[model samples]
Structure formats: structure tokens, C-alpha cells
Target: MSVLSATDVRRNWSQFNDDIVREGPQFVKRNRDEWVAMSTEQLKAAFSNFTFHAHLVQEDDGTITATLDQFDLVENGSSEKEVLEALTYELIEYSQEYMENFKLYFHSPNRKAHFPYILNVVAQDHPENVRQLITCQAGVK
Candidate 1:
């Protein structure tokens, strides 16, 4: 791995972009902070997923628009509590990386209609879980 100062990164952004395109990815530092990485593949994958979500709901702005109609219908349509509990359990069972990606999915600029609903379900009855998620989002350990 390579570390770079923010100034070096800013001063040579084009070079960095070329590196990302030529190589797989490149590490970028900003203000002496290990802020994030630059990767053509990673960005492409993220945006592609976002596009898939947009297509699911016919949104042109590239945001998620997951209406209740998008979810699987219950046999008799249960209460939100039951649905939330089920989803929370699934989230807890999945790896932390999955949950982190989920957070990103929800916070996309082109947010899905049901994105908030999904987050609410995942956060319910799990304050610690929610905090952990926030920590991950803030890039804190």
C-alpha cells in the first residue's frame, strides 16, 4: 500500500486518475488523513449498482425509489414491526461489510423511496447496532 499527502494528491490529481485507470486503484490522502481510495473499478461498480436500483423504480436521476410496492407481499400483509424485526435479524446475521454497503446504498444521492423504510427497520431495537453503523459511516474505528 502507498500513502500520499493531500497536497501531493491534489497537485497531481490527473496523474492519480491515470494511475487508477492504468492500475486497479491508488491510495489518496487528503490533509494528512487517510481519507479514501481512488479506483475506477470500485466507482464503476458503485454507480452501476446505483443505476440498477434506479432502473428498478424508473427514476432518471439515478436515485433509489423503493416504494412499498417493491417489497414482497406478505400472506396477509403483516404489521411494520414484524417486518422490521425480520429485516433487523437479517442485517445482524450478515457480515459488517454488507451492512456498511447497505448504509451507502441507502444514503445514495438518488435515494430509493423505500430506502428510509429499510433503514428504519434495520435500526429499530438495536441502538448499539445503529451506533456501530454510524461509526463505520464516519470511517471511525
Candidate 2:
């Protein structure tokens, strides 16, 4: 899990996003003291939560906190959005693993039975994003 300050969040949004999917969750510091978290899925939910810091946890009295799962919940729609967000995150994460790094943890025989179909879908949907990520890492156009 990577940690970013509010300023870091603004300056390195894409890298921060890569970290979220590459890792699992990220912490964002506010006012340089308090912390909040956004999940890999939450960042892609960017389409939904256009508000910066929208994923921060809110207390009964509405205070921001560092909790993660709370921030990943989808509002203002049916569960389909949540399902789609989860699928998108999985697509990005596994495509990075399989396409860029050549890692095949998901392809292990024991795991293959459960993950094969999902892996196939990710391969189909995210090859371009995977290519772009690799190109960026390689300093190529």
C-alpha cells in the first residue's frame, strides 16, 4: 500500500492509480496530518466520484478517516455499477500482471479453475491499457 499526501495525490495521480491496482489500497494524507484511503477500484470509479477526496470515510458527524472498504462502496445507482467497478479493477490488475510483467500467479493450476474465464475477459478488454502502461514504463511513445 502506498501513501500520498494531498499534494502528492494531485501531482502523481496516474502513478498513484498504478500503485493502487499494483498494490491494493493507498493512503492520502490531508492537511499533512489526517489520512484517508482510496482503493484501486475507487480511483477508476473516478468516472462516478468526480469529486476529489470523494472516497474518504465520513463519520456520523462527517469526519474523514483512513478506512478503505467504506470508500469503495458505490452510491447513486444499482449494484451493477459496483459489479462493473470490481470487474474493471480486476481487469486492470490482472492485465498488468499477465501482459506487462509476465507473471502468471493466476495461471497456477490450483487457481486456474477459478480464474480462467475472468482472466480471458481481462485479456480481451485491457490489452491497450496494458500496452500503454508498458510503453510509459519503457519511455517509449
Candidate 3:
């Protein structure tokens, strides 16, 4: 509710940043445009409750396949570990591409709901961290 003018934010940029770090997100208004400033940690924490739900299948060939419940992304590998790593990499790549084409993706009916999951992936910033969030359930082969 405490929105600061763009000019005031620019004039006290350092203090504004400090305030955000100490007090969480801050809102700023500029000529019909509104923005919220917060640290990466805050952003990550905001989406911490989101998780990647995946279905895992053991192929007859002894390989493993994982398919995410939230997105149309799948990965196959020789082992569960390899599959998880590959899936994490795919997620990071997808999240980056989603942000790169945010407007297009955000407007798409099927993709709009993916925002929180994408943010969760982006916030991790590493494949290992992302891997930790994936919860896999057994799937009938």
C-alpha cells in the first residue's frame, strides 16, 4: 500500500534498495506504470511452496523416463539419477526461455498457470537445487 513515486525512488536509489532488503518488497509508481522491487532471496522465498511433480517410468530397456505433471517436458536416461539431472537441466532451460518470451507465454491460456512453477525453477539458479524440488511418483510402464 505504501507506493513511492518513481522520481523519489530514483533520487534515493540506495536507500530504496536498502529499505527493500530490510522490509521486503517495495512498490513504485511511474506515469501509469507500477513495479515492485525485492531481493532474489525474497522472490525465491515467495515461491518456495511450489514444487515440481513428476511421474517416473522404468523402461523395459532398463532406462528411465520422467515426465513433469505441470509442464509438457520429458526426459529419458539410463538411470533415475541421470534422468533427474537431465530433467533439471531441461527445466532451467525452459524457465529461461519462458522468461525470454514472457509476454507470449504469459498470454497463452495453457502457459499462464505455469508462472509460479517457472519462478521456482528460476529462483533455484542451479540444477542441483532444482533437482531437490522434483518429486517423482511411479508410473505404469
Candidate 4:
């Protein structure tokens, strides 16, 4: 991963974009915080390859809404912490169910032939996600 200051990014915006286009991702720092810059293809591949990003939004009704858009999943709570915890449990439950169905269908020769390669691609990019899904499916805490 490449790291650059905020000023460096502003001064060399073209070069930075070029680098991300050729390379992958880069980190830019602004004051105490840092942000990542990646191409759309990179972001799409990351999300489609078993990675997830959760976003929290505050509503006018005094509730916090947490959303993981990749799966079209949403959870609401009174506080940010509550919503996040809910999202975690929801993801685990959903993954377990998905794995259960996948395992059942995988017994078929056609399904077995096609799905494993896709899963293998995801596993190659995000082994942790694959492991977590299988582990969650096993009903392990």
C-alpha cells in the first residue's frame, strides 16, 4: 500500500490517479485521518469477491440506520453501537443460511462444477470471508 499526505495528493492529483489506474490502491492522509483511493474496477472486484463495507447513517427520527449495500442488508437501532452489533449477527445468520443452501445444491454435478470455481475465486481473494461463512454455517461461535 502506498501512503501520501493530503497535500501530496492535491499537488500530484494526476499522478496519483495514474498510479491507482496502473497499480491498485493508495492511502492519503488528511490531518489525523486517512482515506483510500481505488479504481471502480478494484472496488467492484473487492465487493463482489466476498468483501463488505458497512455504512451508518443518522435518520431524522433519532435512529441510526446501518446498511451493508452489497447484500442489500439493513439494520436499525437507537445507537450506532447497537446497529453495528445487529448487523454483525444478521450477516452471520444470512451467511449460514446461504452456505447451507449452497452445500445442499453443491451435491449436483452441474452445480458442483460451476460454483466451486466461483467460490474458489472468492476464496483466493478473501479467504477470511470464506472461512468465516463456513465457520458460521457450522454453528460455531
TM-score of each: 0.31, 0.25, 0.94, 0.40
Relative to the true structure, how large is the alpha-carbon lDDT of every model? Answer: 0.42, 0.42, 0.91, 0.62
Cα error of candidate 3 at position 44, Å: 1.0
Show the colliding residue pairs in model 4. none
CA lDDT of 133 in candidate 1?
Answer: 28
lDDT of 3 by residue, 73-93 (tens): 999998888898999999899
All candidates in order of TM-score, best leading: 3, 4, 1, 2
- Root-mean-square deviation of candidate 1: 16.1
How do the residues 1-141 of candidate 1 rate in per-residue lDDT, one tens digit apiece? 777777887889888778777775666666556665645355544433221110123234433222223333211113333333433344444323335677675565654444544434343345444322221111111
Better of 1 and 3 by TM-score: 3
Clash pairs for candidate 1: 63-110, 64-110, 64-111, 64-112, 65-112, 65-113, 66-113, 66-114
Lowest-sum lDDT 10-residue window in model 1: 132-141
> Where is model 2 more than 4 Å wrong at Cα?
40-141
TM-score for candidate 2, residues paired by index: 0.25
lDDT of 4 by residue, 69-131 (tens): 445468888886576667766665554555668866567554454342234333333434432
The lDDT, on a scale of 0 to 1, for candidate 3 is 0.91
Best candidate according to TM-score: 3
Off by over 4 Å in 4: 1-50, 103-141
